[model samples]
Target chain A: MTRTRKPGISRRSTLALMGAGAVTFAAPWVARAQVKTIKIGMPTILSGRVAQLGTSSRNAVMLEVEKVNAAGGLAGRQIEMVIRDSKGQPQEAARIARELVNTDGCEMLLDGEASSGSFAVHEVARDLGVLCIHTCSEASSLTADPKQHIPNAFRCVRQGIHDSIVGASYAAGIAKTKGLKKWATCSPDYAYGRDTTGEFVLYLKKFAPDVEIISESWPKLFQPDYTEVVTKILQAKPQALYSCLWGGDLTSYIDQANIYAMFTQMEVFAVNMADYTALTVVKNLPKGIHSGDRYIKTFPPTPENAAWGDAYKAKYNEYPTNWSWQNATAVMFLNEAVKKANSTDGKKVAEALTGLTIKCPFGADGTVTMRADDHTLVGYAIGWGTTIPQEPYVPDVKAGDWKTIFELEAEWKKSKGYT
Target chain B: MDLDALASCLASPACLVTQTTSGLIIGMLLFLVAVGLTLIFGVLKVVNFSHGAFYMFGAYFAMTAYQLTGSFALAILAGAAGTAILGLIFERVFMSRVYGRDVLMQLLVCYAFVLIFDDVVRMIWGPEFKSMGMPAAFQVPPLFIAGGVVPPYYLLLIGVALAAAVVLGLGLARSRIGKVIRAAAQNPGMVSALGINTGLIYGGVFALGGMLAGLAGALAAPVRSLTPGMGFSVLIESFIVTVIGGMGSILGALIGALLIGLIRSFGSLGFPLFTEGLMYLFMVIVLVSRPTGLFGKEVA
Candidate 1:
């Protein structure tokens, strides 16, 4: 009775209606298939003591990606990031990297890990054959060592060797002026810490031969207590100290060292301390401590740099760290490469990235070059300065010369058989 | 067996003295964290895996309190009270159901809380390091002890921690509630049969343990930077302390914490590269030699 009463369509009409309904349902899928988006997977430490490293990196990347999208994206294709937390574990980083490429359909990889996790991601990128831009790791060998080099993986962040040469040159001058002959080192015990500290010391000794490292303490990365290290330094009675501890570790080290008047006794030259993360967090930040400019708005002393820093702070409500700038540079480089290649193919984009020079705010001379040989970033305001108690923490910024950095880096690579 | 290294570390008598003092300060702070963990395990017969999360919360809570009131003492109180309240709620709501369950079930519940607490902290504070500025009183110049410079705050930490230990030791030994807690730990069924509210006793003990951990966190806040997973390192150290001290023994916790602290400080001086491994090595030695721990009794 319902069939008789219902105003049912004829068989042909019903078929046409079903076809129309199917087309309507499939229309968005058709549009979605046509509008392609480039998916870049980021595996970074998003938890643990150095979670800020990941947070800032992700923030900067998102900011750049947002800009690219707002500017109509790369070749009219939107950029999407699939970010994963490695919890600072190397195996987890590898797993997430693989999963992002294999399972999540990510075409490119943005390795946001520190040294340990970054190595793992490097291998994964190699195995997966995805274009990977390392944005956070500063460990020299990740790019400098020919053995570990992958054609698809390039580092956009400052390398430890570059920073060491610049930092040592700057610190050597200060040490000579201050007559700081005796030296002690308290660096985190890891590849980045050990390698960077060693490189800095090597250069420092070369530049200032009178400097003697009487004491060396290699505290495990993220070691909560620094009492023993401080005591060791005091026992040595070094006139100066050098450390590669960054982020919260540096902040904690400074705070604990201050408690024992370590700063008063010895001039500290922590390469990672000039960043706002440590400077702003350090309570009663003792003035006159030397530090490599990690990421101060005023360090590059460029209007563009200051404007970018201001924009980041205004957007995130926090000062950007070295990681923020490095990741921003990475996304910028990636965007440029995509545009230059005119395709999202990993090989093509990677080829395009070779020796790519991008004019960005963080650069030393208004430009940073991706060194053709090592595939590592060559510029981006590498320098050291003394700390002040207030904003523009490291005033009278002294920028490093990239030419000298590159020359020394090449020598270093040759010595290490990495040329 | 590098004599040169040993000699180098021992060359400075003042440094040795300062290291010893620093070890004691570290030990006392660890005792504050471990004592609560051991107490909870001993009384509840459940490993409180979320203890570290509790410690993290304590630090964050103390930071907030310090920001609001600008009083260090009040910050410590706020941290302790906040964590205590959190522990009580966790015990009454979640832990109570898993009391007689399998150990795996109990661990799962506690571990879930750890993850939840970590995420909650990140959500509230954001994933960035936070510093609780040292109070003005503790900012005095370094104190010279045995020709070595020591922070005035280090002495204060030692003093407060020792006071806490003495009060806790006496409370557990002499007070009526302490007697009941000891009795309940030994035989909760018997305590229940004797008309004692075992549930209330368990909750109170858990809360008290959390309070101690919170106290440690609050005290440490001024010295160490705060992170969402900051408690993890402390938690691992506490576990090592508990394992070496015997999981259920208060006195054992004290000795174990001191041993670890001293080892860490001394290890850093002599074998800086292996300092972290040294702790685990010590734990292994302890476990192999004395499974029940330094003061632990064999549970029948």
Candidate 2:
């Protein structure tokens, strides 16, 4: 066997060289770290139909950053946000996160805009050992999947599991009141969609044993065509559709489904149905459509929400979605963590973020507290409402049980083997 | 698996009826898009990768035209004209330079347009989906066709596709210009020797192809929501159509598109999971069984 001293340099020699290089590289970052401004990096989708998701998140982060900086920044240090467009792609997100951490020296990361992108960034965070917060991703696996779990990574948004718990519990009531038992699923064919759909269906059937899921349709996210899906649903004659489709895809589905009289045949219970951006594009949003929103001013119907909405509208010329609240909360959580730990050190802030509570401005019940076990945020303003033609597009906000959400989320986490 | 889908289809008569009509309407639109792709390849021998972009431009142009004029017909014509001009520019500026180049160079040139057109559309329309309100004339009550009710707009779409076929397909097969085109495609050097500018022929073919795509997009705008990447969704199915129907064969495009359109319509009803897969399956089988495609000639 040829002793392959084959490489340009031996592994041990390379390590020695790298060790020296690391020390040299570490000095500048160390010097920069002493600076008062804490740099935060966000990789988000900024183009395509789903651009609103990222744009909303970026605006939200900026809004919070503005407030924090105005009050003399987080822990009396000004926070700077360096944003990059992920294009809703996983690899791009991961690559951008690494560059932000390694190159731009982003001390903290907000890895999200999409669940898939969030997961990719989570792995990057784990490898880089950064105090990272998942801003808008809702996949339960971000915190629950044991293999992917890391101490430094935490999600600041409401998980899909939380949404489903509230959604299913609310759906059971709809099934009973309207006698709409025959169910069908029309979710985007991805983790967030599949997870939310499965959980909602599994729990709905659990809630109402007699409820039957007659059919299902999994169109790819950002799917342009929903004709076949609509026709299939029409053919199935299901009394209702539980959809996880959102943004551009959701708007397209509603418009096309309307053409096929899908709304007439069955009630559409869409989890992400109430974004003002998409609602305005849709020609005819049917009245009395059962739906839920991520974040809207009318949901909490409080003065705080009103002021925030007006301020957000004044800034962006558009109403904020759940992303606005989710992202704002993440940055606010960062502020709380840094203040609590009294340092921006990744490990210390990571430790401090566990069990941290903040006044969630969009919380239906006032505030969300971070769970210590998983470092995942809970008590988001979770709720469902009816879609009506108006400025808010979602009114008559009915709050979901936060205590039930936490309890179910805990039980669900245990089932998934999450600590 | 196909048998399972067939079984599912047989179980629902109304589903079968609605699906068939829906498939044909979709197929007709695919035919419009595919016909242009096939014709361009047939005449110009350039695999125009940005054909879908042309289709997208058509939808946008028609939509804007309709918005400005408040006339559906003018929008349709404007869509056709708008893409034709773009296609002409693509041919004269970029495509003409790459005509004699390697396949890779040609592919790169057209592929560049895909990115360019996408961003351009995004700049103009933003990243949001824009819904085209159904024109009043086509908003008549749905007609009961076979066992299912059909949108009147679908019929109008069929009519537009048929008109395109008559003007394009028949016109290409019958007219003196069509004769020149066919001859030019067969032996461009020979036609050039005979004092005809093959350059004009290539531009015309490219423009016509773009027009057809624009027409399809314009027609589809009412039924389907217009988004920046709407063209990308059409590209895959269009590829499947042109592949099944021999590249550069007009009749081949028509038949292949209908075949795909029907497969999707019925496939979604029968086997929803395999809608896209079925197209790939057919393509693989066609490639293996008949490399020149169903109607294509084996290139020497």
Candidate 3:
């Protein structure tokens, strides 16, 4: 079987021989490859259940690349973004991260937005000595405790603990305003879910002191139903509700709640990433129904957000969403960092990023400050909700429509009291 | 209440409401994908592994239809019809050959279809995530529900699901064809002896299952948003629902859906820390004792 007919192989082998011979003869030309553009790798969840997020992120990054290249290029050379879909799987993320470095020769890695994907790529970046400026995934572990994995990996978004602190405090504040002192939580049953919930409970307890946790329910992530969970929450009769569920889980929760009128029953509902992705997916969710009335509106656009938002709308025929905006801002910051460093060296860029700040189009606080401590951003974290809309752009405007209720809140200040 | 606390509460109401709404939407999408799996397993005596693939195809089909005709309605109709056709083809060309085969073989074949279907999507869609817009008619703002903002589309979703349940239930209970399908489900050999075309009935049932999945994909596109692997998430949860509701029971699917839905909602609030474990916990409990489900009459 290995050598049935050498003559037949040689006759048919001429084509194969020619194929290899041609490539081999062209080897000198391939070796003359010049550095026309700096390649940056962005492995996102492009084609899976969370494919929308990844796609939106990639589009945002690509838009940044286009803007950068158009504006005299970066350092007299065009910046090229090599995007690979993680498919929201860690194994695939690791594999693709390696390929991006080995095959594509990407200097910097931007945006592995999902927690698992980011964690997977972090290890590969450490081995490759590649600078990974994360715009989204904030699993906490990625930034802290080098013993666990890569201490070199840095995230641009707020961590899991920060989210819990913000979400819980908001819920407690609602309870206080309503003269109620009870709180409950519903979160997905996973590491991110559990950690966020636990941290929220701790912080809420620390702040309120008097408010009680009436009940707690942990449903499995991506579980088909939320009805049973809803019943248990209503039975607890908490004054306010807290949820760490993001993405599709948030959408599922809202659908089930509408059926049982749970939305009407709860005094307050606090979702960590609610206005971020969930609101985008379930756009125009009963307007005034949003609890905060903060970051939900698609109008009254800021100057910074105007250009990107307009461009996104023109291309996708939809509003620019949270993940998309975050990703764009992340790439912009990364490009600025590279420009300031004037080199693609990972360590030099990391050094340049320390104490360096850039204004982001998506930020409400005018600028995003990259903290030197863990390389996490210290700038604005915007949260929005549904409100009574006054925007003329939207029609059939009910009494309650989504609006930007909160803007540029100082929620992530490093505390002197933590010790 | 302190003035500072009041101010903070007023400042961040969006966080409170978005969480609640997000959970609700997720549950609704799960029902669409899972209910069909429950039905196929309930009477067919085999887990429909290809259900997710059908769902993935439905979303893709909707995308194709939407591209052809820039109308959400046309896309939805095309999605349903195309999936139903695919289901018919699936039953006639592939599934018909597997009846009475070992459950393992049935599962393996279905699993293989998943690989094939996923690759097909990748080849066609080119590994890109595409979003489908909601119809202008359905983009209405939240109706006044006790002085709260709610997206009117959500109400439409609930209405559609409830109406489907009612129509399906009534048809199954009253229609002559329904009786025949039920009889065929109960005793295929006996129905065949009575001169019924069991093969055709099975194909029709599978097609009906496919239609449900396709409808689910259409309804979900607006809420879940479109992407390549969107169906897999639906598939996993639906499997849990089918297992919990008893393999082949529609009522079980409904009850199980509500159970899972509420569990998810409460889990976000109650045991928020372990919210991800609630469904698996329920699954373990159901499988350990009854092994059929809450509404399941028999354990396979």
Top TM-score model: 2
Interface RMSD of 2: 2.0
Error of 1 at A57 (Å): 2.1
**Lowest lDDT block of 10, candidate 3 chain A:** A400-409
lDDT by residue (A157-188, candidate 3, tens digit) is 75565555555566556557776677777888
User: What is the lDDT, from 0 to 100, of the residue A107 in candidate 2?
Assistant: 91
True contacts kept of 2: 0.49
Return whichever of 2 and 3 wins on lDDT: 2
TM-score of chain B of each: 0.97, 0.95, 0.88
Q: If chain B of candidate 1 is superposed on the true chain B, what is its TM-score? A: 0.97
Candidate 1 lDDT over residue span A2-120, tens digit each: 55645667888899999978886879655554487878899988887678878889999998999999998876778889999999999999999999999999998999998888999
Q: What docking grade does candidate 3 earn?
A: incorrect
Interface RMSD of each: 1.6, 2.0, 7.1
Give me candidate 3's TM-score against the actual structure: 0.68
Q: Candidates' lDDT values, in order? A: 0.87, 0.83, 0.66
Q: Once model 3 is optimally superposed onto the true structure by TM-score, how far is the C-alpha of residue B127 displaced, in angstroms?
A: 10
True contacts kept of each: 0.62, 0.49, 0.19
Report each candidate's C-alpha RMSD, comma-separated, in the order given: 4.8, 10.0, 10.8
The estimated TM-scores of all candidates read 0.90, 0.91, 0.68
* Candidate 1 per-residue lDDT over residues B1-300, each given as its tens digit: 234655655687677778888788788889999999999999999899889987888899999999999999899999999999988998899999998899999889888888888889999998778888789998888878777677889888888888888898999999999999999998999999999999999999999999999989998988888887788889999999999999989999999999998987788777767778889999999899989998999978
The digit string of per-residue lDDT tens for model 2 on B236-288 reads: 78988889888988888888988887887778766677788887898899989
